[model samples]
Target: MTAYEYKVVPAPAKGERARGIKGTEARFSHSLERVMNDMAADGWEYQRAETLPSDERSGLASTVTVWRNVLVFRRGKAGDVAAYQPRKLDAPKPYVLTTPLAEAVHDQQTATGTSDPDQPLAHPMNTLVALPVASTAPPETPRLGETPEVARTARVAATDNGVEETQDLHQMSSILRDRAARLIAAEQPGRS
Candidate 1:
């Protein structure tokens, strides 16, 4: 049997309770819970869980935040590994809204270098853009730029320099033919 190790953070306290507002706090808690449930549903068993303390500044705040971690494990036969794949959950779509105040603030900041130093640093918003989704089906053909013939030729050429020299001669002939074709095309343009 093949052993597979996985980690997951189970749903936090917020998800267990019916919270009126689905704010950032609720989302964070829900994310943790979803990860745990998803892993458990995939045959993974909980191995461990721990709470990570917040930094000194944050720890002293009125509402302290701590990281909740969970680890899970699973085992399967080598042949069964491929068939045990689970479907991935769809990512939440982004909603766009215009903010006149935000736009004005941004414009002012651009005009004057002076801005709120206490505010969080501006990050590249596009960094969070979702990557092109991939299909679950296995690829039908080898990936692009991967040629078995070229690979074999390269291997043979490396081991046998004499074969490489012969291959170079054939390549030279092809190059010469290409150059001749270009020259003929250039000359025929004048006739046209």
Candidate 2:
């Protein structure tokens, strides 16, 4: 499990006032661009912002309702071994051909004066089907002094039953790259 530290601050105003009106605070969305830029410098990420309702009794028969925005910021706690600990990924076992066709092919190849045991058999009725065998080696680990960008690109796309997937930050590159290419092409001179 991952742990996080949270900070709650008053949401910035989109209108006239800066800190919002006291007591009867109006509903306004905070400018997250500024907050995110500032927080990103300090290694904090903006998770989400929430607006809560605060009700106060103005009189015996009247209740005043006020909505205030609460900006939430979170950062992963540092030095948490569990968060950074590498998950064990067991490699897939290689599959050996155990079908009757395979055995027959082997026998036929032997009878035909073929000495190579690894040679593929070509039969009319019993066409030998070769299934791809997965490697039995363990998953590759990041070497010392390796950058995060390199490590991210080297991870295999598949996962096993008992292992959990690591957090990936570079999955959107393909989509973003296509969009960027289209944008660049559109800006080029003289395209009617």
Candidate 3:
């Protein structure tokens, strides 16, 4: 509703040194703080800082871009009070997801009344809560006239399948060791 004026100035490159400041980072921050305070004392509200490019002549006919840091400040204009009404922003719409993940969340919410996780209706003394994994993808059905394609998977015989081929991780290592031993023996001509 009110018009505004802006002021921009070059920011301090280094921090101001003080008796109590120990590190360069601390000193630099102190310097920046001082600049902000000085501007605020003059009734200027602190705004955002920006990096802008400036073009400068490099040689006889060449130009180069130099990045410059600046601090921005703003205040209500003293003279202009009736012009430039800023556009009002509309509120964002509520997010409604209909995916399987959202459906799973809804299912879990109904099961334990975990919709409000802070005060779960079913669980009271739980230190850690693990959310149920939702079905990531829906199964694809074959078209009316088209047959479903099948993948060829090797069927291992019960006799040929060793203990090393078991689902256990430790058992898999035994198979690797056995294969390594067989390879070493084959490489040696003298050892049958």
Candidate 4:
């Protein structure tokens, strides 16, 4: 929670004269502006103007209630903390898929040595496949401060079930990826 300090001061009684500024209302507004500006320069925020009643003796025994105009201002205290401000979430990245599904599946199958589906490829997930791409640019250079990617074949997810189960799941994913690619390819025109 934030703590604030408040200050109350009397409003200007009269406006200061200025060239080309004519009218009682305009002059009064100018006077108020002067007070507000002065307060602002001192790091005070103008809150509101109030008309407060004060009782004072008019004569020997007569008492009268008089209305007084005062300006209110407030500022954050030295030890005050700022209000909670939630951080904005970053925008989600879009998936950019360019290749026609059938073509991509064919390429992936060829690279993974799964082009002949009759026989299973040994260590399918262990082998890295480099698909044909149009870009002639030399392989990307690692950006500054970016950690180098760990070789996929050497990386394994440690799970409660032994490493063999993890390898089985990994191989299953590779099979699914290939199946999904082929299914998508079968939907494309001119693909068997």
List where candidate 4 sits over 4 angstroms from the true fold: 81-192
Give the per-residue Cα lDDT of candidate 1 at 130. 40
lDDT of 1 by residue, 50-132 (tens): 55655334445556556654454454544666556876899988855346545655655555564774554355352243435
- lDDT string for model 3 (98-123, tens) is 56646655666677656764564454
Give per-residue lDDT, candidate 3, residue 112. 67
Clashing pairs in 3: 15-28
Model 2: runs farther than 4 Å from truth? 14-30, 51-68, 98-100, 112-192
Query: Is 1 or 2 the stronger prediction by TM-score?
Result: 2
Ranking by lDDT: 3, 4, 2, 1
**Model 1, TM vs. native:** 0.22
Model 3, position 48, has a per-residue lDDT of: 98
Model 4 C-alpha lDDT per residue in residues 17-48, reported as the tens digit of each score:
88788998898889888889999999899899
What's the count of clashing pairs in each model shown? 1, 0, 1, 0
**Taking the tens digit of each residue's C-alpha lDDT, what string does model 2 give over 28-126?**
323445666778799777878899999988979899998988778888898666887788999989977677656766777777767586665555465
Query: Which structure is stronger by TM-score: 3 or 4?
Result: 4
Q: Which residue pairs overlap in candidate 2's backbone? A: none
Quantify all predictions' global Cα lDDT against the true fold: 0.59, 0.70, 0.75, 0.74
Task: For model 4, name the residue pairs that clash.
Answer: none
Best by lDDT: 3
Return whichever of 1 and 4 wins on TM-score.
4
lDDT score for residue 66 of model 2: 88
